[model samples]
Target: GEFGKVEEVKESLDLAYMIKETQNLFKGIVEGSSRSMQIVKDLRTFSRIDEIDGVIQFMCNPCGKLSE
Candidate 1:
């Protein structure tokens, strides 16, 4: 019964083409994920630098005071 089912499935479609298409789809997903991660990393680094700059500027300016 199992062998008959396997033979019937095997006759239905091209396995090679399916495997190739699956591989290409996975490759694109991996590349896109990698690119997205890189962009997030760069954004974090930029935000940190901007925060530091703001702190430095505030410290350097004597008029930057808070009255409470």
Candidate 2:
């Protein structure tokens, strides 16, 4: 009876560990996706610098002339 109880506990512990690992995997996926979305947003923002008349370019490059 004691041996059977030990086996059950071991199985339960294994299941718990698997669940924790799955949760961690999902968390990493979400974080990676958020970072990717931010990169895309930043790219769009910089791409629109042409529409803003070189304001961003001036800020990034001090030597560049800023249009009045």
> What local distance difference test score does each model get?
0.84, 0.86
Clashes of 1: 0
CA deviation > 4 Å runs, candidate 2: 1-13, 50-68
Provide TM-scores for the models: 0.63, 0.56
Query: lDDT of candidate 1 vs native?
Result: 0.84
Q: Write the per-residue lDDT of candidate 1 for residues 1-68, one digit (tens) a residue.
A: 99999988887867878999999999999999999999999999977886877864565565876644
Q: Name the best candidate (by lDDT).
A: 2
- The model with the greatest TM-score is 1
Error of 1 at 51 (Å): 0.7
Clashing residue pair totals per candidate (backbone < 3 A): 0, 0
